[model samples]
Target: MRDVCVIGLGLIGGSLLRAAAASGRTVWGATVSEVDADAASRGGYDVTTDAEAALQRAASADAIVVIAVPLPAVENLLRQVAQHASHCLLTDVVSVKGPMLDAVRRRAPYTRYVGGHPMAGTSRSGWLAGDTMLFRDAAWVVGVEEETDLTAWAEVTRLVLDVGAHAVPLPADSHDETVARISHLPHLFAAILASVGAQGGPLAMSLAAGSFRDGTRVAGSSPDLVRAMTEGNRDALLPIVDDALGRLGAARGSLASTGGLAATINAGHEGALALEATRDAARSGVRIDLTAADAREGLVALGERGGRITGLDGAVALGEVS
Candidate 1:
């Protein structure tokens, strides 16, 4: 990426600014807050509150513009970027991809737009919460559409690598569906648990343990941000919520049956193990493909090929034997 401009210097945006500056690149940042602009300036980046001005300053065919704002602000910023810096490769760090992709496609039809979501950040907001190493080793989803320019995609992936993140290429729809299950659903569950516990009175709050605190940590996230994410992707999230409710109902039914609760707990434990194993395999740069008809044979074949079977998720098994 050549000259890169980050619009909205919140946690993700601030972190991006820090990373880009560290990489010795020409980086500019824009935020509405004077405090954030000062912070970005202090961090060795040219900062401004006027996003269009920043884009205009950094405008180039090789320049990259990263929109790091929340979902609600994405469309407008995209439109501004398209109007001000049409030649630059545009991307965003919004959590929900489907809507953002559609908006980009609509507003910036001529600009090369790559939808991005850095799988990083804490329950924190604004530039003050920024960590230079926040995205280190994190999975940064790069949404690859059919019309995505390969050169622009490479520029985005290069930026991902420059920021010490792994670029996981995924279709926008797939990215939304996957994050709905793994990200949005958990946030909703955390909010629900926190809300219920809060309503249980002071005694319940006092009696809460590490599990409760840790599990509901995300509930402390910015309410507006959470609302935007959940509401923006409600279509994808609803089905996951329904599936979760169905599973919960089954577990409740099992609690009244012989060994049902134990089986449920055991299943969860196995699932956690599998997830961890798959994570490790991914970290080790290993990929495994499995067939349901001969999963045993597949495992044997993997092992023979010097690949190790680490985990199984539904019909698929993954490992890093090599």
Candidate 2:
């Protein structure tokens, strides 16, 4: 689109507005905050605090209105857009897909709306964290349905490219499942791990080093953001979190056996190796085709690299050789 209206003026909205502007598109930012409105205007976005005004601006310029509000506010915001911005194409930068897409479908049936989540951010929130290149090289998930128009979808993809992100098309259900496994689950575990470790006594915390710090970094995020995501996508997220806990329990139960320590160590090594492989796949822009044999080889390599192999079948069973 040649013009874009970004609602919310938070980190994601502000960043997209700036990025779109940099791409030579006419961009405007709408927020409830007067200070942020003035700042965005000064920063070169055609700024307004009024939703109607934003819609009027979008109607004249081939604008795609992006709702960058939190998950809880997305529905009402979409309603506002539908009533005032009937001519503008609609999308969002919210983290959850099921709730967002469902809300848009119910509230704005006539609008060409898409649900999107650009998987890039820092702990920082609000207008101050806006960075023009925040989405660079990141994957932006676009949720679509059978009713979605091809032309609207193509324009959404182009908007993602304009912001330096690669668009990954997914149905709302698939997007919810994938995000729950990768994003929501991690944040939940991170917060839980940090809390448990800190409660173990001050001295135990003093000894926590790189691994602990790195693992718990996401615990520092805005609790409201985390809550919104976990609550909004609870149907998909609950099962994933339960499965993770099951795996953790399995490891803990195995730890009480004669070779429990070795088994636990093997599991840790296997996990690390799997993560390395995943990162390698991402960096190479290829999807890894995992097989039972490949997993066995990875476990064998892990044991050879000083991992304690609990049994001869450990490599085959764990599938980590790193």
Candidate 3:
């Protein structure tokens, strides 16, 4: 029987444990807190507290230790498992991969490690929030490095498939960059927008529309988790934020320019279409094949339609062909 050990009992970790158990695998879950261990045990995990004991279970059972702990805590867990789980392949569910990959390389060089991030989660936390379908249809990014072993990568891919998610192979840097734009930047924007909304009076909040709620959905996530993502991935995140701000500034300039308002309005329509196109592409697996030229064309079209491209007169002009 294959034994899998999950090091955290949070939503992602808990869900993996549940899925493994459902797959007829012998799965054990560990947590620092007794409450979580008890909850996981009740939820059908072979629960334990001893790190070495958990590592032993993982080592002997063709075990793959899924470290579901926070980003900072991951390094220690990997090191601990490396010491006791020499035979087990290790993986993690961290959103930011670059730093975690670096830490693993430095501290657990001898361990078979594959970085994993299932692009599925909710604002909810804890073992009770786990669901077997949490990862279904999600794009699971598997970060691979030069030193990664094929067998370990294959096992990690199997785990991803077992949980009903498709594996997307990406280098650590590429994974971090792509997620910074798609996931991390959006979280930061949501937090900012949510904070702005809170400053509005109660009457303003009472009249909030679906757009506001939808835009700020991720703001309800744990602040600590968001903070870690912001700081830990700051190197990759800053440029995305800069790009967002650049777009916003362009939009604002266009809105203020004479006769640019109509084109700016048309830009909003284009934006909606673009968003829909992105969603469709993701569902159809087209996003995985986007190229630099495709991205450049999209950005150029957006700028042209938004009336942000300056003409020879150095003014935002409508009907201008760039």
Candidate 4:
């Protein structure tokens, strides 16, 4: 197994450190957080507060470096990565991919880099909140760009698969757009829902049940972390937010005019069912030849069609499409 080095040992990063080490990969992590570093070290994991030393060690060991920081801190971190591990096989767990790739190009141009985002997490942060099984069966986007290094992509794919998550091959732009709706938008909606529920006083708080709890669950996440992703993906998220507002406006108009919410409720119900159907759809096995000339394109198309790379078999990727 390829050794792994993770920087920024928060929930996602810390979890990856634990999962990768458990998968028989020699994994070590660095975090500037003294508390988190201490916690991870006490857990019998190789962790350090000195990120620079970790990066230098990763460079020497030819380890795959996973940048596990939020979007705002990426540029600064990339500078450190450039100084230490400029030629390493690099990937990241940052939520927004487009900006992350941009930062890599500008700061660490020599690194064999792929952008990645694991579509998993909870309203938690720091090392103590990390769970080795957090990414189990989740969709982890392994970036595929026109100029992407396929060999490095495969290495990163292997690491993701090793940690018990399936890989979703996508270009950075497409990944940004998709997550803006499904991930970022939900965070915003959760914040709004929580605030609205709070305004209803003690009676509403007492009556809050499954729907309210589920809807507002992510709202409990750290505000800074939420802003880092949601605002970072705002370009893609803005249009979706507008579409949502327009739908709400129409619903309000109908409620005032016809005294009914049938259209709004029915649309939501149908959307939910459609999502469930897609999740439950039968999948057929498929293979992607990583050595082929059009391999990256094939992978992107597969992911766009709701396919997933379950595990790799040498240069041929083992996968299925729904």
Displacement of residue 192 (Cα, Å) in model 3 is 0.9
Ranking by lDDT: 4, 1, 2, 3
Residue-by-residue lDDT tens digits, candidate 2, 1-322: 4678898988898899899999888787789888888888777677888977887777777589899888888777777887887767888888888778778778888888877889899888777788999999787776546666545755776788778886665667877887898899989989988998889889969999998998899898899988988899999998998888887777788776553666667877998898788556522122212233343234223323322212122112211222
Query: Tens digit of lDDT per residue, candidate 1, span 63-136?
Result: 78899998999878877887898877888899998999888878888877888998898999999899889988
Distance from true position, residue 158, model 3, in Å?
Answer: 0.8
TM-score of each: 0.85, 0.82, 0.82, 0.98
- Model 3 clashes, total count: 0
Model 4, span 1-322: residue lDDT tens:
7789999999999999999998999999899899999999999999998999999999999999999988998999999999999999999999999889889989999999998999999899999999999999999999999889888999999999999999999998899999988998899999999999999999999999999999999999999999999999878899999989999999999999999999999999999999999999999998989999889889999999989999889999988899
- By TM-score, the best candidate is 4
> Which numbered prediction scores highest in lDDT against the true structure?
4
For candidate 2, report its TM-score. 0.82
Clash list (residue pairs), candidate 1:
307-321, 308-321
lDDT for position 198 in model 4? 98
Q: Lowest summed-lDDT stretch of 10 residues in model 4?
A: 231-240
Off by over 4 Å in 3: 259-275, 278-322
Report the error of model 1 at residue 6, Å: 0.3
Lowest lDDT 10-mer window, candidate 1? 303-312
